[model samples]
Target: MSVEIKISLNKGLYLKEPQDSKLGRKMIKHSIMLIEKFGFEAFTFKKLAKEINSTEASIYRYFENKHLLLLFLVNWYWEWVSYLITMNTMNVIDPKLKLKIIIHSFVAAHKENPNVEYVNESKLHNIVISEGMKAYHTKDVDSENSKGFFKSYKNLTTSVSKVISEVNPDFKYPYALATNLFEMSNNSIYFAQHLPKLTDISLKENKVVEVEDMLLYFTNKLLKK
Candidate 1:
């Protein structure tokens, strides 16, 4: 994974120098700002264009639509996390420790890019939940769009399962376990703030077991026979 001269997938195309980078960062920054100012339900192309000091046509060059823009914003964080993960384990070979360090590295990745950690994650959640609710409640459901989103989510879950298997080979229902693990971790924050009753008491604790801890513990409990 000794990758060099990395270019973020979500960054805008073309430009002379670091302005491209700044402009790209501003897009993500403004996206967060807009989402906060007007919840996902109220988000509009015109608002984003105005906030970024660009026209809808210009923004369209980078993102085809609002959904895609949110997807890019969400994916950017994972891509950055992957980059950080590769950077941390130069000589580490032990699988279990690798996963643990991966957890540590995840937190460090957040530290490295706080924008995605704090801002975009919230926006990402809002977008995801809103769309999901829309599809759920709507009668004519855009089958294509729902299927596409579900497919991407499935792949993401499978990827997490594979990572779990890499650390401990015998975890039963790897993907299912991974799904519960990850879905709980992500939703805990979003849900706890609202439906605290649906959450377990452990999630209420000040010192809680994080997603990585749950994954690592599941690995040890199920695989270390």
Candidate 2:
């Protein structure tokens, strides 16, 4: 039996929840595919509508605009990652082992989940690495931030930061280190694939062990007392 996981997101992100109906679910399924294939700059409601065999107006009924749709997808990824970390670390008594598990979860999040039929997590992960920053790197970020648009990402950071504090209560920058590790996991893979000179790991096939090794190496050295 495949258990469906429901991730509740901010209500303000969409005029209508995409998971509530067949059409809405189709919209999300095709949007992630289209965005991952063409990049966000070229993705629009018309393209999504055509890909899903729906009308542009129908997509607008669900999302206010493309940017909001992107935010919704990006936020969903953050919450998914947070869930992975929790599930992977559950009942693990050792803080060091838990942290290692957390790092592995971050790298392994790109793998497809059979439970989430609508969202192709591997493609969604590619979208996140390539386009996630645009969700918040905007002039209206302050306004959106005030509306709790970034709560998912912040909560994920806070949870990992707690684990870091457990590992070393005296560590001065637990939150910073937590966020850095998360960002580094994504950034390193992005660099390895596109800008090879910028990263030490080489992108060959779909394997990510080298990336995981590099992250663990950094984590061990930085947290060493």
Candidate 3:
């Protein structure tokens, strides 16, 4: 059975929360689908408004600009990932296994959640892989950081860092490893798909398992004291 999940993102990522109204929700739903369909660079409020039969000003009321909307979607993706890690690890006793599960969750092909039809998680995962970094790689990043724009990502790294510490209390670079694991999880697949020479893996059948195994191996070796 597929479980339904509600994702709440950091407030600073949006001018007004989209979940508060029907049109607001529709905006998010269509935005996710459109962003996945068209790359983020080509996505715009005018296009979104036309798709939803609403005015661009209506979207502006919820978001200051397209950047904020993209940030909100990416932030929501990270929070959803964190939620999955927490839910999957609950009641597990082994730290190593818990970390393994976390690594696997990061690279695994996303499945659509039937209950949450508005957000196609599978497409969202692909969007994150392709355009997630654009949300933070800008001149305004410093100002955004000061406003807690990257809290979900930070929390995600911290969550895995804790697991690393659990396995080895003396491990000195938990945060670094945690962040690296997160980056590499998406990066390996990105490289494999777009720049095959950069990665040994491929998008061939069971390649996800290979990537997962590579991550687990790296993580286990690093966490092993």
Give the lDDT ranking, best first: 2, 3, 1
Instruction: Please provide, for model 1 over 64-140, each residue's C-alpha lDDT reduced to its tens digit, 9 standing for 90 to 100.
Output: 56665655555554555555656666577776666666655442343453333224444444444333233224453
How well does each candidate superpose onto the true structure, as a TM-score?
Answer: 0.64, 0.98, 0.93
lDDT assessment of candidate 2: 0.91
List candidate 3 segments past 4 Å from native. 1-4, 112-114
Model 1: lDDT of residue 67: 60
Candidates in order: C-alpha RMSD to true structure? 6.0, 0.9, 1.8
Candidate No. with top TM-score: 2
State the displacement of the C-alpha of residue 16, model 2, in Å, after optimal TM-score superposition.
0.3
TM-score of model number 3:
0.93
Clashing pairs in 2: none
